[model samples]
Target: MPRNSKRSTSIRFRIARSTVNYFRLIYQTFNLDIFELNPTASYPEFEKGLLATLKPYRRPHAFLPRTLGFAAAIARSAKSVFENARPIPFNANQPLFVASTTNQKLAIRPIFDEMTTDSFWFDEQCKECVSTHANRLRIPFIPLVMLKALLSKGYRRKSFRHSVATYCEIHGTYLAFRLAFASSRPSCIVISNDHSAFFRTLEQAARHSNIPTIYVQHACVAEHFPPLNFDYALLDGQDAAEKYANKASRSKVFLVGISKYSKSENESRWTGSPKRIGLCCNALDQTASTIEIITTIQKSLPDFEIHLRLHPSTPASEVDKLIRKCPAGSVVRNDAKTVNSFAFCKSVDVIICGPSSMMLEAAMAETPVITVETDSNTDVYGFQKHGLCQTATSAHDLSNLIADIETRDRGAFRKAISYFCEGFNSPSRPQASSLAATLIENISNRQQIPTNWKQSKKHGWWRYSSNEPELEAETTA
Candidate 1:
């Protein structure tokens, strides 16, 4: 007994948990956010700190812009300082509920429409959001004194300025939502993304009101996403489900396929030999590096033309910057969001991009994708590790990779993209929206609440068990 007592009895947590707690502890200590609060906005800051530690160059931003935005937001909220707490503007008792992002409005629209006609939905409290769209709903902003206290506590150290400002926003917004939900009493909350601190705050307030939450996968998943802790999660396929489970997801998972996309025939663009290269760029991409990747590839493949597809959300000035700096062979096109995505994917022989869900979309379109890493740092989705696509580290590496694939059959290069999404090519399969809508409706009705992972004998629809540990069955000797 004495010999065995030498070992430590203290509990040990996983590395990721320890890392998150480290950042959370920093927030608590500096902001004095004890007893009086629980915060969710610290997630992004944790990510910034972790990423900066992992990749030194991508450090927490320089002081210039962060300070400006912090000051601006504080000043902007002053106008609403006299405003009183407002309730959600709706005819009281409608609880068959859901919430979505303004950016994802188009994708979520069909799902919402399937849920009900003439439903009034609201976006997050961002000033940029229209607040009221198709059927407008305005949620009132409530004034709070916590901002002043947080701001005062923040000036103790100039370096913690950004963190203090971020907390003020999160706490303030959370109180407003809490005030609203306490009165509204919605039975459940459904959301498309959890990465946003505001969304996480909404979930917190909903839980405070004893309301259940549902999550739908709106974009690609990676190792860095927060754990899936919603009451229910409708995932795209096994890839997303497994990733969520590994992250210790607490939800009852469902593989409802990609709710936004439907089966369609892609336009044929390849004729005789391959000629065009489509480079996809969105707001999330690093501009200088993406431009460098495209420019280098243009010079390498002189025989082929390059087309740059700028996402719709990209700024008007970005078009000018890309066009002026890029090689003459590169043509910048800004209508990517306006046109059909599948058709645009088919317009190129091979697609080149950084880590984005577009790689999976290209696979659905049956187009070959080459994911350019440019360095060891930014492969956020691990496409190469998953064998989902071919990765190139530098311009020279990318150019050589392109040369080898330029003449190869497109069919041979296509990766198994179905692992991330389900039932895209098969027209006979039911669409993800209808299935998701039915499930949502049933959940709202409090009927057939499932306990474990099971599949429908009829269509093989996934019904997951919340208690099943993802890898409980597998044990190594």
Candidate 2:
């Protein structure tokens, strides 16, 4: 071919690759994932992490097929999506989406149930819930969005491919909700999941439509959690407020204590040396380590009765595996999922835990929780630094900590709770659910934000009040 003809063909190929798919993928990747950047890191470190994706060589072309394939699968999965889901819109009377976990559903319900506004419990299937009002969120689809996203570019690294696939999946998610919002608009949306793709899509859609978004803290967070960008956020305590403070300017943060609990419901501490111990493990823990933790504890504290509690996500097979691995003198139980965490806290004098939000929950219940690193030494929740719990590096360390806990006055835990929680639900103040529900109702009515939530003029963060009780004196480990 002539040089001119060859050059023309190359230009066409490049242009073909630069269609809507490539641009949208790049744009949304930056727009959405920027929030996921670590706020706790210093300026230079933060800048480096944020710009990693946007490096001149990322190409971003390989993302097209993954996004297109996902979008096509979604479209094909529900042949009559328009009939069963796509045409559907938000709950007309009270728009609520429960796209999070069963536990989050439990955390969010108390506040949602308090609202006179019509809302419904939603599971992943988009089925009509059994609420007094038949609340249903009709799944809606927008073909154009997916079509545009599928329009063309083509590969690089495996890790990069997986990351792009996830980001593209959210595009498909965002498009469906975008169409749904246009169908029948609601006054506001309430959510408890900030970490999920679906919930984040709904949040992004709601913001685009100028609809108010309310976030209730269903669980504890890490330093890596996205900033509080919701229009209204009901936080569990000061720990959360501080973690998200750097990026929370746009969000109105209410330091409502954990909404799931009502009144000061604490476990009754034993008057003498502890007679029972609970060993709790989450999915993050390895079975070998779990067995070792329990066996070591049993050997170290031979007189104490030990109960093993597996997380809800633990499979039945895993449970059986755990039971078989239990030490001869120890008792293995998987009933922790059936009973509430607070109830589990009450069942034992002290808890030896893996990295879980339950550490804080158990602490709030006045249960002495000792965290042990089962899989890795990483302190995911900062329980030890915050003074809520004692950290044990090994099974032996935990055994010694258990003995110390026997002699230590449990009142020292009260100060730790203050650092994390405004207060356990109490008669002295409104419950977190009530405060959050009132705020939601007021916002729905287009009324002024209640004066009780004050924004700091200096830092621009909102707080329910600064009248929190002073921290009790620090106790030695």
Candidate 3:
């Protein structure tokens, strides 16, 4: 080939790669899977962990007595068997997707059969589930969803391939709903959130069937969010309600308290001894800046031990590289199994990390929390807005804060934490799973959602959806 022709082909290839990544970046921003970047990480392992984190854990089912109108809404798999159920059709050439263990566990416990995004495990039991309740288990076809996504205005963007991939995922999910309710409709559909493309498609399908859809809060909704387009949003607490409830969204918000995964073991306590400082790193992209802050803190507090808690998504190799750079015996990485982050925070005198939900975790653990941010304006989880922790803008500021932590009076900090905790967590909160079950039952039983459970939409919901608006078209740099 001519040199000019070769150069043009190379440029086009670069643009295509960049376009694909450009769309992927949106999801990555919320849940940064550092492992995905590593060449050796298997997609199965990555998918499993990601699904595990997102899976809704078991909780209390509605336990109202027979005397009251509200009876228990529990359903056992054995009692609800569909032995000769027909299978939802899809391409036989494509692999059958199995429900994850997490999903399977939930399916056995909850009264309702769940419809969630597939993480690609097609086990024998799931095959049996398809055989038993084929109507509820629609096999997803990529081509159908992709085609629908390509046609929808909501899925179109400046780039073609990336948008199609995302839309297909969403549309495929919609098709599952379409198939499931072909002859029969669900009483209601309960989802973790409506931010993702899959959930959005499910929501639309449920809406079409006149079936109510509920949105369970999954993360911190601390201001600047999109309009929530759902029948209801079951929030974690008043904090989530205050931030997410709005006028334009036309969605109801219920304060359900902390999510199952976020429910602390309730063993948090401060020993009041200056020994270890826990550093929960989330600023992976700013690795050089993080290392500089760590080194400075180590130099300033030579005697104090530092326990670095890496994000679960961060690769061990990257952590190993960081460990080698830190002072030997001075800084140690946290073992996720051995060290409970909340427990670690409680045992330590103080905690340091980039602006993230970790700050809130540390605060809940009753430890003094300090955030190190390059951007002075950044306030993750409203730590600064609520005056819940200390903030450091540079390595100098972080070192100074670390040096003075011992002398600082933390009574007010603890007090603020107590107030903050009260609002964020429901008063006398029940087990998350139990609360969720009761909420679902109530909604399905035709109970009117409280009018008070409403909020003003300062931000829209598109931020977390595939249909989120695009930035001006730009190619790979």
Candidate 4:
């Protein structure tokens, strides 16, 4: 059997085994009365159907005499997902790639490895290092396991994979994909951007792939890197373009902003008077220090009503503990409706935050904003260059800045908004998106012509030439 096909078969067998094992565990742990919840009935049915379907196929692991081993693996994978809450979309034949700079082992690789099966691919170094980490942690070696599964399943497909380790590596990854395309051809590519790497990969991927290369913008673009190019860049607003207009090249950036926040029919139950003081809590990173500055400001302005917006990653119990440490009536926990920091920006008068994208979102909402920047520990490229928010250098500075902002004229605040967001408008403004789309479409059209393509030598940073034919000024945007 072909490598890809064999890998797919092995994955199917293992998944079937795992599904059956998971169902058995659920039954053993919970009573029949617990299982009677109709809303949860589909899960059990799906598990059973998956198991029955796989029973006729050969099992991937020969050592496992029964389906119990598969069940254990399923339960473990499920536990991992519940803990992370990050969805891992899987496809047996699709080319998969992960772009990240952090050397630490990621939480999402299991999902991707399983999805790849025998047709799987990744940076060999990353695969080796991450596989070693998994082994050390006693996690199942799912990459090879999935490869075996895919082999049994008879999956045959071509996949090209790469990564962008840091902001600097984004361009290199793009170049690598371009070279890969010039050699071995692939159908399509999908670049997943999670804050750190920026959109450089998507731009290069579009340049290479004969088919559509989708861009899955992982966070609100305004809060992330300066925009570059993307065939179809997903976004929640024009705030990203406004904040990084100088950096954002023309591209077909799409606004499917926060699909999770799409309106539902259900009405909220609670209605209360708006509070005066608001706090945005974040991780202990440099960005979180902005919260510390905001907290200091709230202490001096004792009369203002304070509302705390917690980061999604923070535990509720930790937030409650932080609240208990604060002065009484000075902090209020956010209701479910306004839990996300961006949700709070639209309702608040003044938003004090660190170098978070939330500050940009607040600017997009036309709210007065102050960002506290203390020690140089947490600096990003665009924070200073774009003038996204008023920086506070110290606690006293923050308090004084807040006081000034509180009394500043509306025109002054609007001027600050203009400084941060150059082209504030509705989300539908398509300058960035249109530019990106046109560039990619033109490149794709050029590839269709029968002209001989040329490859340029890869050079160092200073020596790198921007003289490629398609890389002219028009497509560079």
lDDT per residue as tens, model 2, 347-427: 778888865777877776677888875435356556778778887878788889898885665556776776677755233
Q: Which sequence of candidate numbers ranks them by lDDT, best first?
A: 2, 1, 3, 4
What digit string (tens of lDDT, one per residue) describes model 4 on residues 298-412? Answer: 6777666666776666777777767776656666678533354445666666676655556655665545566656543243424445455677677778667656654444443
RMSD of each: 13.3, 11.6, 20.5, 19.2
- The residue-by-residue lDDT of candidate 1 on 279-323, one tens digit each, is 888666677877788778767777877778877777778777877
Residue 340 of candidate 3: its Cα lDDT? 56
Q: Which run of 10 residues does model 2 get worst, by summed lDDT?
A: 129-138
Model 1 CA lDDT for position 364: 66
**Tens-place lDDT digits, model 3, residues 216-254:** 655555444545767866665545655555526667655
Candidate 2 contains a number of clashing pairs equal to 5
Measured on C-alpha atoms, candidate 4 has an lDDT of: 0.41
Score residue 186 of candidate 1 by CA lDDT.
Answer: 58
TM-score preference between candidates 1 and 3, better one: 1
Name model 4 segments beyond 4 Å from true.
1-209, 216-275, 285-299, 335-338, 406-422, 425-477
Could you tell me the C-alpha RMSD of candidate 3 in Å?
20.5
Candidate numbers sorted by TM-score from highest down? 2, 1, 3, 4
Angstrom error at residue 125, model 3? 6.9
Model 1 poorest 10 in a row by lDDT: 130-139
